[model samples]
Every structure is written in C-alpha cells, then in structure tokens.
Target: MTTTKALLIGQRRRLALTMVGGFAGVVALALAVAVVADLADIRTATALTDRLVPLLVFYAPAPIAAAGAYARCGGPACLTVGVVPALVFATLVVAGTVFGVPGVGGGDAPLGGVTMSFALVGLSGAFVGYCAGVTAALLADLAGFGGDGGDGGDGETDAAE
Candidate 1:
C-alpha cells in the first residue's frame, strides 16, 4: 500500500479546502444563531438570548478553534481556521457593547469593562487555539504522525511529496 503524507505549505489544495471549510463552519453557526435570536414569538423559561449570548461570546469560538487545531494536528490551518470564528464572536461582543444589545451589552457595566472583557475573550480564544494546536501536534507525534515531516493532519499528502 502506498502512503500519503500531509504538508502544510507545499500542498495548496487541501490547505485551501480546510481553511474554507473552517471559515464556513464558523459563518454557518453565526447565521444559525442570528436566525434564532431574531424570532420574537418563541417562548422559553429563560430568554433564548440570555442563553445564546454565552454561546456566541464564549462557547462557540473556543471549541471551534480547538476542533480546528485538533483536526489540523499541526498546520497553520489551525490558526487560520480557528481565529476567524473567534474574531467573529469578538466583533459581535464589541458591537453589542457599543450598541446596547439586550443580554449582551451589559448596560450597567462600564465601557472599559466591556473592552477588557472582549479583549480577554478574544485573546483567550486565540491562545486556546494555539494550545490546542500544540496539543494536536504532540498527539500526532505520539501517534508517530509527525515524523514524516511533510504534513500535519488534515489527511491527503501532496502527490509531489
């Protein structure tokens, strides 16, 4: 059986696909949440907005980045795939603070607090992503996946390699 090795920079197509897929995954989730947030008729014990704000601001980006890092297993795609989702959520937080979004802007909190919170969230997302990437790389190494030195993990090594 022939083996295929994955490369970070040398292989263009697979890298592009993963990058696009990661970005799309983040966008799709944001759109889904937006659709849910826009509905006025839905009733729940807790306002969906109250629950979903945390989903958007904290839960979503970190996991997505982590998953991307895990999937990439050691590629730059880890950062590219992870950071977009993080920034998307971060942007929403900043906008919510500036525009007074209910359940999001924390109207009683000082603007400085909002800034610090968003900054923390954003940095945490990226840092967590990096850590995940590191973990994935270590895991790949343990699995004997990285000794090949051509690719990280997203599957399909370059034919030329």
Candidate 2:
C-alpha cells in the first residue's frame, strides 16, 4: 500500500475503535447508574434521579476520554484514559479523608458527609463499568466478533492471512 493509503487506513481504524469504545462507555455508564440506584433502593424515577446526582457528576469527564479513545486508539487505550480520572478522584478522596479534610462530603463539611461517600462510590462504579465496556469492545473487535474491519461484511473474518 502507498504511504497515504496506509496512513488513512490506520486513521480509519483508530476512529472506528474510538467510536465503538465511546458508545460502549456511554452504555456502561448508564447501566452502572441504574444498578447503583437499584442497589440504593431507589425504586421510583424520582428517587433514582436523586441518587443519580453523584454518578452523573463523576462521569462528567468520561465522554472526553471516550471520544479521544475512539479517535486515536482502540478500546484498551480508551479504557486506560477513562480509568485514570476515576483513580485520581478516588485517590484524592482517600487522601483527603486520611488527612482529616472536611467537606469532601458534598456539603459544608470536608468529606461532603454521607452524600459524598455515595457519590464517590457511584462515580467509581461507573468508571469501572466504562473500563470494562471499553475492554470488552476492544476484545470483541480484535476477535472479529463485532465492528467493521474493512471486511465489508458482518461477522466475517478476512482470510487475508
């Protein structure tokens, strides 16, 4: 293949992977939020919405990374990007708690009180789901289970090898 053709092929692959990863991340985040609500006994829509605050807050950065992952690399890289933010947030919360920092709780106090803990856990769970989804998508892509791989057919492996 010519240099330009190769470059374009690589770019297309990266974009496709990133898009898949981003979509998976979004779905995973939604499911995770639902699960959190269910686990917290939020049966009603209003109750679920109320409980979803922290989760939504935590996932604010997820889309940016997901988009980037879909644009440059495959799901594995996308997951790494998504996970780093979650880990950082978790670490900060833990560190602050250890140092007796107040109001981290999402209130007048350092830890934000009970709400803070709930939010933290929700965020963490969403992040975990996002990472899992990205990894799963990447694996599926690599295994030729899903996604377009220039094969022009669904679920058909290219026998170019």
Candidate 3:
C-alpha cells in the first residue's frame, strides 16, 4: 500500500516534526525570556547588552539542535533539516523587528540597526546550523554509521577483485 506520495508526505512530516523542536525549544525560550525580562523591568547595566541577550539566547542552542537533527537523519538531507528551522526562526525575528514588538528593545534602535541586528541574528543562526550539520555528517561518516564500508578510500580492493 506504500506509494511515493505517501513516502514523500511521511518524509515531510518527519522534517516538520523535527523542526518543531527547534522552534518551540530554542526560539520560544528566547521569546519567553525576553517577555519575562520586560515584565519584570529587568535591565542590565547596558541597554545594548540587555537587547543582545535575547538574540544570543535565540541563536545559542539552535545550531546544536540542528546538528543533532542532522545526525539523526544520517546524510545530506540533514542540511535541509537544520537550515529550515533556523530560517523559520530568522523569519520570525525579521517580522517582529519590522512590526516593532514592544519591550523587545528592538524598537529603540535606529531603523538600520534594528534591521541589521535581527537579520544578522537569523542569518547567523542559519550559518551556524549549516556548519553544525556538516560537522555532524562528517562525524557520522567517520564513525561508519551510514556507508558502504568504503570509508573514503578508493573503491577498488583486493577482496572486491
């Protein structure tokens, strides 16, 4: 009963499910921390520092989770798995910046700065996630987790002949 359509759907579903962890875990945590700090009127010694904390939190674990997800998939498909979630988060950040989310500390910066900062946050998250995914793939390859036993050597061998 298995069809190509069903298989593709299942694959897409798996990617979506994996991405939810990155979105819910890392991005949501960052948003919540920003909200809590705002509600509590918490301010660090420097306004810039206070504003940057959320961005830092948002980007920190994103790549790590992405790497883990890529490792789970065991191949190049992991790039999409890692990058998609990070891009999703970045899109949210850009939208929030454009719309002026209150108490996010993004509103006070100059338009250019705000745009640059949020854009960079998202872009950097994606870049880091991509790098992490590559590293994970390499490690997996080295460990012989998913391979035909060539292990990066020439295809020819005495046993094969």
Q: Which candidate leads in lDDT? A: 1
Worst lDDT window (10 residues) for model 1? 1-10
TM-score order of candidates, top first: 1, 3, 2
Model 1, residue 39: C-alpha shift (Å): 5.9
lDDT of 1 by residue, 1-161 (tens): 01122223323356556654766565546544663555444456136656755565555555555554444433454445434544555456567668766555445656555555654764577557657655765577678864444443345565665
Question: Each candidate's lDDT (Cα)?
Answer: 0.52, 0.44, 0.46
Candidate 2 per-residue C-alpha lDDT over 64-141 given as tens digits, one digit per residue, 9 for 90 to 100: 434433232333443444344344444445654576555322234444344345445444544555555455545655
Across 86-112, the per-residue lDDT of candidate 3 in tens digits comes to: 444455556666767665433454655
Please give the distance, in angstroms, between residue 67's alpha carbon in candidate 2 and its true position after superposition. Answer: 1.9
Which residue runs does candidate 2 get wrong by more than 4 Å?
Answer: 1-58, 105-161
Cα misplacement distance, residue 16 of candidate 1 (Å):
6.9
**Model 3 pairs whose backbones collide:** none
- Model 1 bad stretches (over 4 Å): 1-41, 73-76, 81-120, 143-155
Candidate 3, which ten residues in sequence have the lowest lDDT sum? 1-10
**Candidate 1 TM-score to native:** 0.48
